[model samples]
Target: MNSLTIALDVMGGDKGPHITINAAILAINKEPRLHLFLCGDKSIITKYLLEHHIREHPQLTIIPTTETVAMDEKPSSALRNKRDSSMRKALDLVEQGKAQACVSAGNTGALFAMAYCVLKTLPGVERPALISALPTHKENKNVFMLDLGANVFCEANILYQFGLMGSVIAEQVDGITKPRVALLNMGEEDIKGSDHIKLAATKLSANKYINYVGFIEGNDIFTNKTDVIVCDGFVGNVALKTCEGVAQLVYRKLDRFLSEHFFARIIGKMLAPALKKLFKSMNPDQYNGASLIGLRGIVVKSHGNASAKAFEAAIFEAIKEVEQQVPEKITIALEQGLIEETHTE
Candidate 1:
């Protein structure tokens, strides 16, 4: 098997090196082909590795960084001031070809800024978008959503590009042939939504390479009705956070109701195993990583408050993208789509 190198911004997340170091250890152990460069303060990372007794493991390497990007740091501040930060160095590794991909649970804005500044976008990509898979209604099936807070707003052309990007992810990463693509809007009607959205829809529908399914409302996101859902960062971010909130509410309400009475508690105990499995499927932690697509290199962003297991999932997410050559695929798709558009015009 071919070995893969990934860089982790150990000091960028909420729990700092504590969570990322453990996740690195977990990833290296589970995937023998993985070699991780832990980018952060050497002293802190050394302490964690010592605690785990794998300080000198061949699969692990430390890339000492003097600074760390704070969770609340502004994008401009981080980009201009934190050059040697753990987050910046991790991205640098990818840019330098020392690592095929990088994963971080850091400031979203800062990471995006550093990544864009460092790796730049593929030839035809204007801006990168955050994308990740979500569990759908069908068993063992998932749907991909894009623009999860990568940009505040996008024009019609950008949104049209997002649909193309999302379709490639669904087809190449998820192995869905000619995946159905939809625009997330207020209504499914052709005349609804802003003019840009309508324009994007018209462009998508006309693309023979894309299987455009028209617009879908928020309620249908998890219904497996569409393989790819494209929207601006504002709406996608809100929809993602809303799903997380609703999942937590459901678990809390179910647990409280089950423990309210003696008979109910007994029933809960009886259903504990199944209930645990159900909640596990719904947990946002399992889906912690969101890939920033359209860049020259691969980057997977973990949730800020991700636990060790959650962050480990992010590392593996990067690994998958590396193996899949996602950036190359996106470039080809965009280039082909652009040529087609030019001919039509």
Candidate 2:
């Protein structure tokens, strides 16, 4: 139980204080040395803390913040106007060294803005990208995709940096000594994609730091063809949401089909366990949450619709990141000039 304090934005997300508070409790229970600084309405947190009989844990602290950055608020305006918001307060904690990391299910854009503005980025990092792990069928192998709505328009060099940063995360977390990297394109051929990707492919292929695996189509994302997939934020976000929508549709269709007939219903019951396991494996919440890589400290963004379990998982994910010293490792890699230009024929 390492003494790692995480500042949590309690007022953020659809679930608000209820799910966030409960998840904090769950994290504290799991790790005794974990201290949580809940930033939100103090009264709300106090009421739940007393009701849950979690009194005087020494590890739990509540910071009073009255305002909250709404999900729909403009990131720039929110950051400029709401100085006392819970999200900003959480980032302040990280900057002040009071917390090792910050966790939020709040406004994605606002969170990213606050992180960059407060904590800043490491040297050689042009922009801090949002990286998340998606479930894959390969055993002990999960796929990582980055620029997930962080930088909508990225340069060729930026995409190459995403690959390098993502590869470091995969190797550290998944134990992949030499993680395979790929450029996300419409086709696998060399002459596919735009000028951005064409230039990126050249740079990634020429760089010796990462194991470049040429180009990968959107369909190959889950086929274990590559360990890390790099693309601009706009494209990556679209791919992520599309996969999520398709998964939900498949589940709904299966449910409807199974109940259409008595025999099918019986078979569904018999196969429920396996199906549940498969679904669980594919769910995004089970893997790493969105990490604000390239920043000085750890900052994780959970799904706005995340449940108590998902929040708990995000806390542990942050813990693993701190324990692994990801930021330090990346800083070393950057200093060594491991991120270089690559060219593909």
Candidate 3:
């Protein structure tokens, strides 16, 4: 049987090792051919293993690390000061080729910093960006949004590159061949936003390599008008978080309205199954992870508040990314100059 071992950081996150350990166990049970290298305090992991009665799985192994990178701590400090931190150790396993991928629900900034420092970026790529899949109304259709929180400030050329890379990922993962790419702007016209938007649109439209769809407003996101949406990290991150907040508000409102009265409660009971299925399809946790694109290896960033189910989904995402050799494909795209660098001639 082909074996794929993943390095999971157990000591990073708000819940410490609880959610991390449980997620690992859940992933192992879901995929028998999968093995996990748990990096954290050995004693803590061992205790959880014993408590959960998961002591004797040949597929599971634990690697001890003395320190941990905190959520608020800077990545540089964590890397330089905490040599034995679980997050750093996990990346080390990936660097050594001992693991196929690494998953951490821990510090986001630290993970990005560590990944760039260790794995490095592919040739022709400026900086790595975070790409996430957001569900849309169209059946089996999802939009790929990038620079979710990687680089807060990006140049026009960087946004153009993000379009190319985001398009590649959308085609590969979402099966959207000939994906339509768009720049996130306040207006759809050619003349919109600041000098940056105009510059990016001009450059993107001139690129024969990308199917640039001009500009798309934020409201157009749910219309499935475009397959890939590219923007700076600041705007992308705000949009992503706004969507999440809206989803939560809707869920809460629905729950309160449904349980408030006897008639509504009866109606809710009748529609519970269908409503649950619909909500599950739209839940952020169901799509709780983002891929750190442009890196040399496959690295996924899961939600900080991810549950076992969400973490399990992240593992499956990692498996698929590795199986498809996404990094190699990206390298090929970069080498062929499919992504161009803009110059002010």
* Candidate-wise lDDT, in order: 0.90, 0.86, 0.83
lDDT of 3 by residue, 1-345 (tens): 538988988887677788888888888887888998999999999999998897767888899999989989987887678778898888888888999899888888899899888888887688899888777888767888889988888888788778878878887887778789999999988777888878888777777667889899999987899999999989988898888777778878988999998999999898889776666555443356788888888888878877777777787888888887888877775554444433322
Which tens-of-lDDT digit does each residue in 255-274 have in candidate 1? 89999988999998988897
Backbone clashes in model 1, listed as residue pairs: none
lDDT order of candidates, best first?
Answer: 1, 2, 3
Candidate 2 lDDT by residue in tens digits, 71-170:
9999999889989999999999989999998899888999998899999998878899998888676876789998888888999988877888888899
What global local distance difference test value does model 2 have? 0.86
Lowest lDDT sum, 10 consecutive residues, model 2, at: 336-345
Q: Tell me each candidate's RMSD, in Å, in order.
A: 1.5, 2.2, 2.2
Clashes of each: 0, 4, 0
Q: Ten consecutive residues with minimal summed lDDT in candidate 1? A: 279-288
The alpha-carbon deviation from the true structure for residue 41 of candidate 3, after best TM-score superposition, in angstroms, is: 0.6
Clashing pairs in 3: none
Q: For this target, which candidate reaches the highest TM-score against the unseen true structure?
A: 1
Runs in model 2 lying further than 4 Å from the true structure: 285-288, 338-345
Stretches > 4 Å off in candidate 1:
273-286
